[model samples]
Target: MAPPKPTAAAMADPSPWRSPAQRGRDRALKREAVLKAAARLFNEKGFHATSLDDVARQLNVTKPTLYHYFRSKDDVLFECCRMGLEMIEAAAATVPGSQASGLERLRALMEQYAEAMTMDFGMSISRTPDTALSPENRAELRRLKAQIDRALRGVIQSGIEDGSIAPCDVRTAAFAIAGALNAIAHWYKPDGPLAPAEIARQTADFLIQGLAPRTSERRQPKR
Candidate 1:
């Protein structure tokens, strides 16, 4: 006798069927993959030198597949910069509500920022300049950048007021700390001797140390 035919449902259903949530998650994952690939290429080749085709080829996807997630190369770069800014902002947000001392909170925030910079999104932010983006994007990026800087400055100010950190020029200190942390994206390598976590710890330690009150200075608190 001939074998029975497959059920209509079985025949129609696709292999590796996904639920609605799963499908949404899959799309999110694919979009992130595109962004990461684009970031890496943009960092290595510079934004102008890297094209959509390069990103697509790097991800083994067609240009149209990229279009499904991003409208253009500029869009991808904008998202990359936005991702970096969001990461820093998220880290900064934790500082205000934490029970830890202001200095401790600042240390945590700095470490978090360093780790973000070590990632692809942060690397793209560091490598790509504001001028590389559209005027609107450039303005948004500058606004986000200023937000992060202001947050850092606020933390420093709090630390000083609370006596957890030494008195210093808050603006200059914020700039110095940010400049150091942002530079990590330029030189950090996944295969480098120091891991991201270790780099974060070390960088935080160095930055925090500068803000530490000297024993002599601590004896006489700033009025």
Candidate 2:
């Protein structure tokens, strides 16, 4: 026997099929999940020791599932490294129009950087070696590294000029600050006693104190 005709409401309602844009968004979200899973594994076990299987297992998916998003482990590592660099770049981008003084801006940058380092992607960036990436990727990572260094130095110089920070070698101070902030990735634990915010605050306070003007300098007459 023939089936009954559909009701008006059923005919008017659209199918549950996802649109192209919705599918694209779903793909993007899945890819980001892969990246985060990979980063966490890479952070826990060094990049060389972490495999696609490990990442997929962490995400409760098969290794082939990762292939749907990334070409290989190297691709995932490169992306994570790029993400870490982008985080620093993003924080640096905010310095120019910040209402705070140069030193305050620098402190803010340090806090942002510290927070990033404690994250999965940033920790992966800290532990992964440049040699693990292809030559081209290595070169790009180096370029970004240099850019971050320059940004830090520029902030220090601005602080020096604004009289918010004590006079010191900008290059030396930048290296010192960056090194300290980057080191957090090596020791920070998600379950540790100190929260990310507290760690960031303490790190920024300690680093900024080194650049703070001395009492004598603070009392000096304006030039």
Candidate 3:
């Protein structure tokens, strides 16, 4: 038998338009693509040196197309930094849920943090200076960074309490770990001698050595 005739409604409008939910998802994806491209450009060339046109050219789109996704170059940079911090925070969050010893968990988190440093968004965080951001954006980034620091400190405190990590100042240790990881963004290049994973592994191992448990006489008082 022949197929039944199409409905009049379907014939008039065959639903070519995306539904609201699909439209929202598409918009989000496009925005993310824009952010990723902007982040890479910002990392390759200093944030001040990279413009919206540069990002648009990299994406093979018009600068006006970027304005649809981001307000301006400053806004794009802020969003890139925000994305980077979120990635680091997400990596750190995994440690609290793991059953590993405090030191092991800390190492895992550090490795993740190092891996993120090699990504475009993550690199953008360290590459962009606070002075480049608007005052409001600068304050917001500092707040997020403080939150990340607290998370790192919490892990250090746990390691110390469990006696898996050397007894020392949590505040100072967290500062050092974060500083080292952030610095990775500065010197790391895709063409670097070591792969990102190898770099991360080596970096984490080096950092963890300082936190390794020590003899009672060797351990310093936990502060």
Candidate 4:
């Protein structure tokens, strides 16, 4: 008798993202390339003006093939937005683990957030004209955006607790930071006068001053 079929967990394991590692890698690379091409086309020609055909043409593929990876153009756009927010979340998560003070960590996180926004993929979401994105995609994009906001708030809260950041309404502070960082995605560029690192540093410097410990004393009090 043939060996028993693999269980769902077993099949899912070892990277269900790909069974053939090489094929998986190639697919991922292609997916990224297509997304990049789509972003470029969409940015240059507003989402309403750009279509799957446009993206496929840029990548030398067919619309059906594009659909195989992305259900629709909105799907692609959603992916781009999701990517930006996810990057922020991932980067912010790294800050608390660093040896830097909470304020320093917040700065670093903001800087990293700016750097991430400067990336082509990230910029595409913010700069690209997507007036045509279905309400569903737009809503999803906004929802994922909240995730970024929440992650940033957590960082701010950590700063508050550590006395590295001045006490403030966490929601307001977090939203402000999120808005500022998100805006960077709209205007930042790789060829801009300032490098991503420099911009990030400057942003960090400014925010740190405002956020750094105010009382110069510990919360528990000295014996």
Which window of 10 residues has the lowest lDDT sum in candidate 3? 93-102
Specify the poorest-scoring 10-residue window by lDDT in model 4.
10-19
**Candidate 1 on 129-223: residue-level lDDT in tens?**
87989898889999999999989998889889889999999999999999999999989999999999999999999888889888976679789
- Candidate 3 vs candidate 4, lDDT winner: 3
Clashes of each: 0, 0, 0, 0
Clashes of 3: 0
Question: Candidate 4: misplaced stretches above 4 Å?
Answer: 1-21, 128-132, 213-223
Top candidate, metric TM-score? 3
**Which residue pairs collide in model 3, if any?**
none
Give the residue spans of candidate 2 off by over 4 A. 1-13, 96-99, 217-223
Tens digits of per-residue lDDT, candidate 4, 20-86, equal 8788888889998888887777666766788788888888888888876788878898787678667
Error of 4 at 6 (Å): 34
Give per-residue CA lDDT, model 3, range 1-223, as digits (tens): 9999989887795588999999999999999999998888888888888888899999899999998887888899999999899999999887755467789888888999999999998998898887799999999999999999999998888888888898899999999999999999999989989999999999999998888986767657876
Q: For residues 96-134, write the lDDT of model 2, one tens digit per residue.
A: 554678899898899999999999888877788789998
Q: How many clashes (backbone atoms < 3 Å, residues ≥3 apart in a chain or on different chains) does model 1 have?
A: 0
Candidate 4 clash pair list: none
**TM-scores, in order shown?**
0.85, 0.88, 0.90, 0.77
